[model samples]
Target: MSTAGTMLVIGATGTTGSRTTARLAAAGHRVKAASRRAAPVAGAEPVAFDWHDPATHAAALDGVDRVYLIPPLGDSDPAATMLPFLRKARDAGVHRAVLLSSSAIPEGGPAVGAVHQALPGLFGQWAVLRPSWFMQNFTGAHAHARSIRDEGIIRTATGSGRVAFVDAEDIAAVAVRALTDEQAPNTDLVLTGPEALSHDDIAALITEVTGRPVAHHHLSYEQMRDRLAQQLSAEFAAMLAGMDRAIAEGAEDRVTETVQRLTGRPPGTFRALLEREMPVLPSDPAVR
Candidate 1:
């Protein structure tokens, strides 16, 4: 957890990764931004690193004592690839490790959960960030954003269930603290925004802020799964649909103060994020 050593940020071009990299670099912390293409990131050195490619692991680990891990996306079982790399990282002298997981998944539950379960054993200074659904899903290139832009509709199987959609910036701020703080969190943190909102509420906010008409289209679990299967594996699609069903059952209904407690500031709200990132709809366009 030495501040002198470099921090490696995997998925540097991604939602929270990019922001985490920026925050670390801006704070004068040494950072290595890791992406599959070794794409350049501002304020940090960029290196090519893929979870599936063990060959790229050594170079990325060089001079790196801390790591911000974004598990390989779309893989139902990330522990299969992640555990091996983690062991290699430990052998390479890395100290602190912070993993990005989801609120929907818990330690030893599924997907990144297995990695979460093994983190404390791998590194003394380790934290698992389980953030709720991201607010960026409506402003960025996510399916909701794309659908909102092209069709003015938000489709989901999540009925009236509300989620405290957190902002990536807030998540990054907490991550920077976890990485550089004298003491690591050393425990799993569930991060969420200030308020829990449903899809209909989100669509209304977007419409209110952007002056554009947007509607939420509710779909059955089967319909959502089938629709998502067109773009994702059948298993992944089913899992996603199942998450929506879970949401419908009020699983993601509560809010937490993790962001505020860690970052010394209250987490931003969804409406605030929308106003800042998208005050107006795109004339023609495009999270974990």
Candidate 2:
């Protein structure tokens, strides 16, 4: 079997973390997943832990050698809350840490970037997964059903701005490799799809595949921010606005071979992902 000392995974129930946990467990590593909920996993131990609750942190850190770190949800100062837990991980003998970050957030700007600044001195091995906007966010989250049923619109500040949007599955695949196979990629990787497409391009793709007319609704940054403020915390609402502003400014329009370099295969194209998810989207009378 395979073992890499002991790997403790935070956010194991989340999108990338869940897949990474399964991959690590399948590789025969001694893996335990930490989350706020105490759900049983097939091949690993699930410990009840919360980023907000420091009391349960150490027990989860017990006997761990490497860690898969995920920053908590909105409103926590990553430097303050996450750094202490990272210090505890080091104290518990963890020498490697893999952090899941965003490409939208620059390496030293906010969120996981702050943790990136602090990891090298604390751990012997480390990599940060800086993935572009997730395709799953459109399909799995609050937007999917709404987008389909109404064939309404995807409102954004990214007007005609092309983004090489990537899949969470692809991100997970790369993260697994980073966690297991490679030397610390010790740098920010701008993960993206093979081709960059504008919001209208995405709408066109949906129209082609599903035969449904979905529109790209462009909004000014402040308008989107004000609308988001009604739904999210001030900080989180601001983050979305910031990311959209980045998209507007052409920060996410990258196309890279990093995925192929790391995984020995090309990143899945947006068309491929869209076709796979075509069933989940609404039907068009023209196609039907």
Candidate 3:
């Protein structure tokens, strides 16, 4: 499916949004990169946008016909803030929307799920990308990766249950399709990587790749909650621990071909991701 029009990408400098913005621009579509700060993406118009502040919404939606939605972070229920801008976008002639959702959160579940439920009625063309835990969580600017770099340990409450961690690049590829395709899939797409592996397996792979010892520590739900509560609200902390509990219960163990089905290419594997983001060796030979 092929259609061309200006597309707005929220969370413009973020992991998936940056990739989607570059992809759309490279494909010859006009793009509006929206963020709370100026995110001047090459070949795209940059606009300051914040979901909590309705005043920033209109300028971002000015000439866009399609949008890639990344709901406000840290807010348990962003629907209270997001719904109004979405309505405004529709009234301003935006016809399609692609939302970044999670595989753990089903439609009508907590967080972005509320907006996922409301999208269908708001636009004739829309797609909800429900992606699995990101492979980048093990290598990028995530807490798990930070611990790995600093202490050589990956900590989580997920005991032995496996997760099919999809690559953020694959998610972005799917989003491009959802935004530019002539017809939206018009349903929630459950996206996953090619295989499922436990956190221990991920640690082992990192050790193998970096030639440095890495370990996975399994924490109880309560322990994990307490740890996260030090940095986040009690409610949000509990919700995160609960998701880990669900993972331990075998909720995120399956793989899906939705990425390949949409993009005509297999999603990258965890090892491939690791290879691409090779761990940096210390400058001093003694540290290495």
Error of 1 at 141 (Å): 1.0
Local accuracy of candidate 1 as per-residue lDDT tens digits, 137-192? 99998999998877889999999999999999999999998899999899999999
Residue 106 in candidate 1 has what lDDT? 89
Report how far off residue 188 is in candidate 2 (Å): 2.4
Against the unseen true structure, what C-alpha lDDT does each candidate score? 0.92, 0.77, 0.91
Candidate 3: residue 28 Cα off by (Å): 0.7
Model with the higher lDDT, candidate 2 or 3: 3
Superposed Cα RMSD, model 3: 1.9
What TM-score would candidate 3 get against the native?
0.96
lDDT of 3 by residue, 1-288 (tens): 576688999999998999999999999999999999967899899999998888898899998999999988778878998998999999999999999999999999998999999999999999999999999887778899888887888989999999999999999999999888877889999999999999999988888887877889999999999999998889889999999999999999999999999999999999999989866444333321
Stretches of candidate 3 off by over 4 Å are: 280-288
Residue 225 C-alpha lDDT in model 2:
83
TM-score of each: 0.96, 0.91, 0.96
Q: Which ten residues in a row have the lowest lDDT in candidate 3?
A: 279-288
Assess candidate 3 and give its lDDT: 0.91
